[model samples]
Every structure is written in structure tokens, then in C-alpha cells.
Target: MKIKSLHHICIQTECYKESKEFYTEILGFKVIKETPNFHKREYNTWLKLGEIMIELQTAKISTNLNKWSSLNEGPVHISFLVEDIHEAYEEIKSKGYNNFKLKNEKEIYKVENGYLFKVKAPEGTEIEVRDQQEI
Candidate 1:
């Protein structure tokens, strides 16, 4: 068997309202689905970053408390496969997101010609975003 690539990244947020704003408004991701947990009123947000899914689950839903409410731990790094990382940086910054920092200026990731950027979102979820291009 062979392993290919990542499918999605999961994130836990203490405040869904904050993450929703940052992910949808600032970061530019579309919410594809929002469903209640059936047993509980708490829910999850299924966001898409160019076909990639970022699962944002709240503390009320996440069973793994260690990973859910830990402020010390940041959201899981979601690497986007891009054709031009430089262009991505410009695009994101142009949208008024000025806090992104380029981690590797000379090198990129294996998938989608990705470039690493370390940034943060609302509620202090440190994001290691790998800028990627369209397929």
C-alpha cells in the first residue's frame, strides 16, 4: 500500500463565533456544512480551502479535551498546495491580512507546490498555513 497525501485538517476552537469570522471572512473559506451533533446542540463547521476541508469543532463536541481547549496548542497546520507561494502571500496580504509570516522563502512543500506561512486566527489559534495554488 502507498500513502498519497492529506485529505483534511481538523481544528478545535473554544469560540466558534470567532473562528467562523476569521475562517470565513478574513481567511476566505466557504462553509459547506454546519450540522448539530444530534445528541447535543453544539456543532461543527466544515470549511473549504480550495477543495480542502478544515473541520472546526467546538469544545462542547470535541471528545479529546487535551486537543480541544488547550490554548497552548494551536490549530492543526493546513498545508495548501499552490503553484506560486509568493503570489499566495500577496493575495492573502492584499485582502488586509498582514500578520502572515513566511517560514520558508526558498523552499516549498511537496503537494500543490506549497509554501509555508505561520500565522494566527481569532482566539489565538496559531496557524501554520502552507500557501498553495489551484489544481
Candidate 2:
């Protein structure tokens, strides 16, 4: 079978409020829906950024944050296409959310069609922003 398209990316957050703020206020994702999870104790927030959708899931029970690591074996990162990588990177930095501290002169890498850089979400997930041009 062939995969058709991505429906959404689900992120398990240790702190739901921080994750929501980072995705909404920092990254500019809009909240499409918010509902209780299967257990009905915690919340699951559905967010939209352009055509991309993401689900922020709150842990049902208290857990150690140290267990989650960006370098873990599961889904490592999420990438987004931006109109201008430089402008996006600058905006992210100006907002005091540049956990990666990427330098434009060294960190931003050139791809076949554009440039790419990575930043971290509040939960420490790597979020890549790429700017591509029609060639």
C-alpha cells in the first residue's frame, strides 16, 4: 500500500500549557479544537499552521520529564516550509525562543532549492523551518 498524505503529528507534552504557548504564541499555530483525551482527565489540543495540523497531547499522569529526549528513537523532528528562512529565523530569535541559537552564517544550511534551519519547541522537539524557491 502507498501512503497518501500526512493527517497530523501528535506530540506528547510534559507541560501542556508550555507546549500550547510555544506552538500558538511562538510559532503562530492556531487552535482548531481542544478536547479531553481518552481518559477524559487531560487535554488534547489540535492546532493548525497553514495546511499542517498538529495535536498536542497532555500526559494523563505525572511523569518524569527527563525521560523525553529529542535524540530518542521515535519521531525526531518536524519541518515546515516558510517563505523566507532568514526572516523566519530572525523572527524566532527575536521572540527569545531560539533554543538552538543557530547562527545564520554557520547553522543555516543550503539545500537543492533553498535554506533550512532548526529550532526547538518548548518540549524540546526539533522544528525545522525551510525556505524553498521554484527552480
Candidate 3:
């Protein structure tokens, strides 16, 4: 068997409203489908970002941390690749998401590929935005 492509990523969020708004309003993902009572859960929202899809559902447990520790678990972070790093940074800044300190004091970090920055979602999930230099 061979895997073709990733269909979506599921995120369990404690606060459905905030998470929905964050992914839709802030991150510019389009809503494909929304179920108010999915499998007895509070909500299940399917969002699309370009070719990728994100499934946001009500979480059974609450993690009251400010942000999820990258070292603590299964999936570390979800990253989005952009064309312009500066433009993405400015856009995020203009939207008032200034709490982007991860690893270092600076917001954006330059890597071998390009540049990236991390932000915490409503459930403390790490959302990374980055740019890739053409090979």
C-alpha cells in the first residue's frame, strides 16, 4: 500500500468558537462543513486552507497551559508555507497576534530553508508560518 496525500488534520479544541474564529477569521481558512452535534460532540467544523483541510472538533479534555510544549507529545506543530515571509509576518502582526515568542526573543527565525514563526492556537497548539526558498 502507498499513501497518496494527506486529506486533513484533526484538532480537538476546548473552545469551539474561538478556535473556529482563529482558523477562519485569522488564518483565512474557508469553512467546508459544520456539524453542531457531531458524534455527540459540541461541534465539528471542517475548514479548508488551499489544498489542505483542517477538522476542528470539541475536545474531551482541557489543557490549561499557555501553550503546548513541543517536547510533550505526539504532534509538535502544524506549519503553513507562504510565498513572502515578510508579508505574512506583517499580516499576522497587523491582526494583533503579537505573542509569537518561541525558542528565541525574535519573532521570526531564519532557518536553512527560509524563515518561520510560531503562534499558539486557542488550545495551545503550535501553528507555524514559514517561507521556503526555491531550490
Candidate 4:
């Protein structure tokens, strides 16, 4: 089967309020839709950033809730293409997200075709901000 495009990335979080605030307030993602009490005691929110969409879902089964870590075997990070890496980093820091650790000793690292830096969301989800333009 040929995939046309990425529809969305789904993230399950135990701290729903923190995750929601991080994505919406800190990262400036807009909420396209929200379903409160989606499955009784859980919330489901859809956020949009440019053409990318992310679905933030609260744990449906309490017993199955697990926290994410760098040691996890599945997807570890999500990267977004920003227009300016420095401006983006400054903005995030200015908004009191000072806990972010640089992916490299340098504030920005060079990729094959871009520059990138990583930051952890409130729940420790890795987020990479990149600019795909030669410096």
C-alpha cells in the first residue's frame, strides 16, 4: 500500500492538562477540535501546526498508562520545520521553557540540509525544532 501523506501523530499522556498546555500555549499549536470525557474520564484534543496535526489523547485504561522515556523502543521524537531556529529557540525560552537541553553543545546543530535543536515537552517528549536552509 502506498501512503499518500502523514495524517497525524497520536500521543498518549497521563498528564493531560500539562500536555495540552505545552502543545497549545507553549508551542502555539491551535486546537482544531476537542472532545471532553471522550471515553469517560478522558479527553481527546486535536491540534494543528501548519499542515501537521497531532492528536493528544488521555489514557483510556488506567492500568495501561505508561510514561515515555528516551529508552522507549518506539517513536522517540517529533521534529517541526521552523522558519528560524534561533527565533524559535528564543521564543520557547522566553516563555519560561528553560528546562530544555540542547541536543548538542552548540545551540543549533547542522544536519545534512538543515539546522536543529531538541527540547523536551512538559512530559519529557522530545521535540526538534529545525530550519531546512543552509546557513
Candidate 5:
């Protein structure tokens, strides 16, 4: 068996509207397709950012994100590559997003390869925006 590349990341949200806004408006993801009543659920939206797509689905039952704790069984967080970390951070702040946790209390934290910042999505998902560079 062989693995090619990551196609998409599926996110189940209790409220689709809020989640859609966060991914679209805040993160600058474009809505590629939206299917109403998809798979016996309220709706399913496909959001694209560069070459990646995020499958945003509506959960039939209330979704518990586990508060994004490290003890969770699934993914701990989602990270995105951007051209400019400072621009992304400023844009997010301008959009009235203050729920992000900065590393070491710095506006833009330096990682092993590049700079980045972490923000909490509406569904309590931690999203990392990193500067575009080799990693």
C-alpha cells in the first residue's frame, strides 16, 4: 500500500453557521461546495485553502471537542502555512478574534523552522498559522 498526500480534514461541528464563518471569514477559506441535508445531516460544506480542503460537516448530535486537551484520542490541532505570520496575526486580530493563545506570551512565536501563532476555532479546535517556509 502507498499513501499519496493529505486530501482534506473533516471537522464535525454542532453549529455549522458559526464554524463556517470562522473557517471562511477568519481563516480566508473559500467555500467550494455546500450540500444541504447531506448524509442525513443538516449540511456539509467543503472549504478550500490553497491546495487543501476542509470538510465541514454538521453533527447530528452535540459535538464535544474535549476542549482541545492533549489527552484527546484524535488530532490535537490543525496547522496552516501562510506567506506572512504577522499579517495573518494582524488580520485575525482585526477580525475580533482574541481567543488565541500565544506561545511564551509572544505575538508571533518562533518555531524550529518558522514563526506561527495558535487560535481557537468556534468548535474549540486549535488552529496554528505558520509562516510559509521549509519545515
Candidate 6:
């Protein structure tokens, strides 16, 4: 099978405005587009960080979404691209981030010319970081 880099990620947030601000402000991303999906009674927003784009979905229902936030977890997590994952880890750790402890680490999958790791973001959302390349 042929595949490309991660195209996009969808995050479900109860507070659309707050989540949008946090991503734009804290993550150094810019809002590119936003639309309302009446069928789901949700709001969809597109954000960009360099060449990568993230989709933030504000839904009225569970949408299943990320289990972390649904379970009252804090700080939704999204896997990030980095040149050196170890360095990235250190950098995040320096920011006083708590290491994400999960039940999996069984195998590191390699794709898009990079290794991968499943981590919980600061907000408790599960993020899968792959393609450790210089951004």
C-alpha cells in the first residue's frame, strides 16, 4: 500500500472557542478555515502548523472523540513532528510536561519515513507521533 504523511487530525472539544484559542495561541498554529456541520451539530475548524493541518471538531454529542477528554481528562494531546524524538521528549519535558504512561509500547511502527510512539498529550488526549523529521 502507498500512503503519504498524516493528512489531518480531528479533535473533539466541548468548548469550541476555548479549544480554538488554545491551539492557535499555545501551539503556534493559525486558523485557516471554519465551518458548521449542521448534520452533526458541530463546528469544524482547520488549523495549520507549518505544513501540517489539524481539524478541531466541536460536537454536541460524544462523537466518541478522544476518550481522554470524554473521561474528564485534561490537556488534549496530539502527536507532533520533530527532528529528533528524544530531543523532542526532552524539550517537552523541559516545559514541565508529564510523561504519558500507556499500556502500549509493544512495537514502534515506522511509516512516512519515521518511527512512531503513542503518547498522551498535555490535555490527556491520546496522540500518535510519527515521522520524526525536521519541521
For candidate 6, write residues 1-135 as lDDT tens digits.
888788987776766776676566544679898888745757878899898898887665556544454456554455676666566545444555444444355434555677665645433456655565643
Q: In TM-score terms, which candidate is top?
A: 3
Most lDDT-accurate candidate? 5
TM-score of each: 0.59, 0.81, 0.87, 0.86, 0.86, 0.52
Worst 10 residues of 3 by lDDT: 59-68
For model 2, residues 1-135, the per-residue Cα lDDT tens digits are 999889999988877898899899889999999997556438888999888899898776655546456677878788888888898888877888757636566668887788888878877788878887454
Better of 1 and 5 by lDDT: 5
Residues 31-93 of candidate 4: C-alpha lDDT, one tens digit per residue: 999998887547889999888999998878554676778797989899888888899989988
- Cα lDDT of model 1 by residue, 30-54, tens digit: 9999977734437777899776788
TM-score of 1: 0.59
The residue-level lDDT of candidate 2 at 65 comes to 48
Per-residue lDDT tens digits of candidate 5, residues 17-134? 9989999999889999999888677888999988989999887544443344657888988988888889889999999987888567776788888888898898878898898567
lDDT of 3 at 85: 81
Please give me the total number of clashing residue pairs in predicted model 5: 0
Which pairs clash (backbone N, Cα, C closer than 3 Å) in model 2? Answer: none
What ordering of candidates by lDDT runs from best to worst?
A: 5, 4, 3, 2, 1, 6
Greater lDDT among 2 and 6 belongs to 2
- The local lDDT score (0 to 100) that residue 106 gets in candidate 2 is 67
Q: Report clash pairs, candidate 5.
A: none
Candidate 5 Cα misplacement greater than 4 A, ranges: 61-68
- Displacement of residue 131 (Cα, Å) in model 3 is 0.8
Which of 1 and 4 is the better model by lDDT? 4
